[model samples]
Target: MLLLTAVACLLNTVVAAGGLQSCLHTRLSPASTLVSPSSAEYPNATVSNNLSWQYFASAVVFVGSAEDAAIAVKCAAASKIPVTPRGGRHSYASFGSGGRNGSFVVDVTRLQSFSYDPKTTYATVGAGFRLGNLALALDAHGRATPHGTCTFVGIGGHATCGGYGLTSRLWGLLVDQIVRVTAVTAAGDVVEASPSKHSDLLWAISGAAPSFAVVLSFTIRTYPQPASTSYFDFDFGNFSDTPSLAVKALLAFQSFAATSAPPELGTQFTVGRSAGGTLGLRLSGVYYGVETAIPTVIQPLLDAIPFSPISNTSKLQGYMASVAFLGGDDPVNTTGRVESPNTAYEKSIIVPTSAPLSEETWTKFVEFAFNTPVPPGISSYYWQIDAFGGSYRGKRTAMAAFPSDANAFGGRDGLLLMQHGTYSDTSGSYPAGGHAFANSFAGTITETVRTEGKKIEAYQCYVDPLLSADEAHALYFGHEKTHKLKALKHKWDPARVFDYPHAF
Candidate 1:
């Protein structure tokens, strides 16, 4: 709430209101929630997760339906201002605000319509619903979908941008479950995209939708409720105290995940220091079967770390309960804050099989993580490493978006995805070397992996704010996919009407 107020003060700068209001009034419903810079809701409309990206949008439109979204797009195009569809407003670089000032913001929070068809077992939901709300809706019918832990992240961006959840290894990504979608193209025309229809558009949208289209709703293929899980966790004491021991021990865990780990197992290890200055490691996961298997499943990791765990925790719970726990929230409270303002910079490392770290590189990575000199004003930092690509990479089927080729999610081959970052003490005050600190850590791993004679990549969801547009395009999509996206971009948005910073 304080950050929201601070953001309001920072963005209260008055700017000229270009003729977007008149154009929108002609097409949008009279009762539509539209706010310009002069409106009281302007501050609320402009707030976001990452305070580092505080660009002012020319106008914010809380669209009602697909038709209304199209109208907003038409207005932005007519006014010659870039239009960006903001779902959760969680874009690390704030591309949701067009990533620049004076852009038109199409706020999708009002399109909260949802319906589940038990006959097809498919759920049709508007893009506005947050992840928690969508989860509750699905759980009502004894059904669920694979998605990330963040309760407040919007379904629109999360689904399209390769969503990974704790059960992703068993099921698949949110994009993998997308049977079809309704979207507004750059030309202000609405269309549907699925495997069987407008597939190229579907492929272009699934990985990087903002570049080509503004999605209105998604019709997803749903799965039945999964079996209860045995939650397993072991905490290794302070990292700075025993870096060589803990880091080396953790490598064995990664080895097991890449090879012998079962599809029913999912895990992530977080490396961060506590407020008491205790740099520690917490390796936690859930086994989606009997509790008996949990011991055998985690024995290798336990053996690797010779020292006794400072704390060990294991519990059996339903899927939703596990979700709330993993997200650091209580069982009853699922829908978290829609906007969480913070000063942070994150960089991702997508470890492909072709470029896995060797023993030598792994040791070097440990050295860097433990001994590297952090830049100034870096109040706190951490890294989250998730085991990816069990069923995620291997699962292939006739289901619409199941096959690797069905959509544009490019990191299928990655064995592990590491999202690491540093944050500032104050809400909007960025640390002096936040980007450099984050980049150096990610860069060390990336360079070391490349030196081992293979390829390494990054996850687009944890966007790097410092990279150039070209660098981001190459890192996220590589040459071939970037070429494909650009071709589609030209076809659908030749005028670049819906352009934003680092969109493609």
Candidate 2:
């Protein structure tokens, strides 16, 4: 407790210096105390409630107060140790774990405060703001940001690492809409970065931002959202046998992508676990305007899926209602401040060369994701495959410090696919074997894609740092672009204090 108090004192000084003294003080928990793994509550408090063992053993604990987060960086700099900014602890890999050896970690859960500028149509969100809380706040104001599908995703990492959501088609990637970000550099100096201000730093923070620096807060542009949004789900049961059906439906979805999509209309494909080892496909959409148009514009999709004459609801429900339908109840606990463990998993965010869902590639995906168990728990999930291109193309708008490609951002049309293996153990704990299983699963799937001679663009957030520099480079924006990013990292983080694996 004495150590906790001392740390809190130092934290107050650091955050105060950064012009956040009052805000930080107000957000700190009245009864909260910083606990370490060495503390009695360490075991339970250090790991997320749902998934344990997703972090490494050497993580240092910072109990409470956003001030503690600032102090954590200062301590690390003085000691010449590294630190990772942690909030929500939902990252699948150990990217949030600064290093294997004990490193100072700025657990920023206590800093979860948000202030809105209704006049400016902007939201100044603290680094610790949780997605759900953000959602509630915005919904009350009849405005919203394109946050994650899961409510618990932290806005700090989500925005920094390229936050995506159903509204991406209308607004843009979460990072794309961010106007400014407050980040603590390796030197422990707080800097406000944006496209116009610190152009290069802003360019590198998103998609492939270096983690060595701690992101403090982000000010994002928000939209005058509808009073209520509606979500419609069409589930295609018995997916393995529905290849032809899948092909036809996917093609129609691609057509939707090519056609001018209404700013109010956002659509995606989700294939997930079903009864009897069968694959399930859902052509889902969220429309900001009249829920009535859902059936009309989505005719192509409805024609292909196996919707029955009488059983089909072809329904439209409210935004909050849709949240329940999408399994928003799978609570993402924001209470714990510990980091997620360093475990391996098979993951990829690939944008294919084309928008059409090729039958051949779909078949290959099915086989790789289900038939092969190289990494036992790997599963295939796609958010916006065919429909991604229509909304996210051809406009160079102001974005935050996160980088965006002119072609990829709004100039060209494309889709983002997140294929991954979820780590789960029979014993209810992710053991060492679980890590090995995930790695093998990822390798086997990627090899198959290579063998098929298909080239796909990769999203850097889900990538593991273990891949070779060349491999990682190619997986990112390719060798040439990767080189530029590496050079930028060196230029910005000369001392490499914010170092993390594969952080180009």
Candidate 3:
């Protein structure tokens, strides 16, 4: 039949390309679909958000189920080829695409399925489901889960790697909401990890998942839709002209967030080039309450700013509509949620409240950002500082399955999470133009923060491929936690089947 012929052709192609006939015949399942490097689907499967990462996998397996995933792993292990799981293909460093040549990649987007229980308020989600689709599904049931703003990101990767979002302060992180996880181990066994069963596995995957297993699904806690949601957008003018004022305003906001901001309020401060070519600062956020409460919570920061905002907009709407407003999308159709791939580099650092943002540091940031040359329409850059440590403080005790103190994530106790990013289009005249600028900007920021304060740390979720092995280990997981994760890796994936850059 046609299926049989296609399988025959695929087997021949694999043998010709990878030269793993014995392992393929012994371990690969007939139902598992393999896309050879010469196939047209290969390009699509290999495309990633960060185009800078050039991944050349021996084969890309379109896994249809958890069993298929296990088969792919077994085949890769038997063949002595490294294997990595790919969901949304959005890893900043292409960690999802095997991360090295001659490796095998298992793409799990075909495993999309989810169910929500109204009585128990728990949602079981497939690993391959994107955040946007999940949001639409949850909205139909009048429920919501704390997830990142980018709807196209896969939950499998995001949830396991510390899912930070607008409502993080109100409901805690997405990983913290996970009650159970189902994953395929390196030994080709499907295991369910939770608080009581596979407790250590659960703790390890809550943040450092890539080094342990290929997560297939998750059972997460959900919350009822908020009665009303409010949003505010404030443009605080160009930072180049008013460096001192901009830095003062930013520090004031951070100070307030550390001491006064309620759990229901979440804010993000950004410094980037406006559409008109001016470097400016913007403050935008959401309040999970009535419109009347927005002013009371945000007034202090607004009053602290030395200059009046150029533009201010506030609205009270439905929960979904509020999400759209925060994400700058069309409320009714969500048309703004489109994805256009490009080459980019990013780095992050966590600043604790004890080591506040100093004026000298802000001046240096302003100088570097303004001085950086961005190719007119081909490249761009930005610096973002997300408020971190409010309700997150309760995770130490609230999340019994994966306590904040012992997990691999490093930003739980930090006051602000700072991210520096530079992006360039591959089709541009100078494809690699953004690298030098991004490196300089990121290095300056990291050096400034570390020199100014001793308590600063880096976020693991923003995995920077440039980090050394020792630096990555120390930044992603501290000395003690790294050792614990390594021991768990030894027990679960002794052969190191699930490995990538910066992996445990």
Residue by residue across 203-302, what tens digits does model 2's lDDT show?
6665454443667677888887665666766665555655555555555555555544565666777655522245556666677777677767667556
Candidate 3 clashes between residue pairs 3 or more apart in a chain or in different chains: none
Worst 10 residues of 1 by lDDT: 392-401
Cα lDDT, all candidates = 0.78, 0.56, 0.75
Q: Which is better, 1 or 3, measured by TM-score?
A: 1
Candidate that scores best on TM-score: 1
Task: State TM-scores per candidate.
Answer: 0.92, 0.77, 0.89
Worst 10 residues of 3 by lDDT: 392-401
Candidate 3 residue-wise lDDT, 1-504, digit = tens: 999998896675466446543455455666667886787888776767677786778878877788878877777777667778887788887888867665678887777778998888999988878887778878889999888777678888888778888777777788888889899888988899988999899889888888888888989999988999888889877657776777687778777767767777778888887324788788888888989998888898888877888889888899987666555542323223446666777788777655766777766776776676575444567778878764324332122123555455656666777887766645423345555666677666567877865655777667778787678888766677788888998998888978877776
Among these predicted structures, which one has the highest lDDT?
A: 1
Candidate 1: global Cα-lDDT?
Answer: 0.78
Model 1, 250-364: lDDT tens per residue? 6776776676567777888888753336576888888888898888877866777657778988999988787777667423233444445788888898877555667776676
Q: What number of backbone clashes does candidate 1 have, counting pairs of residues 3 or more apart or in separate chains?
A: 1
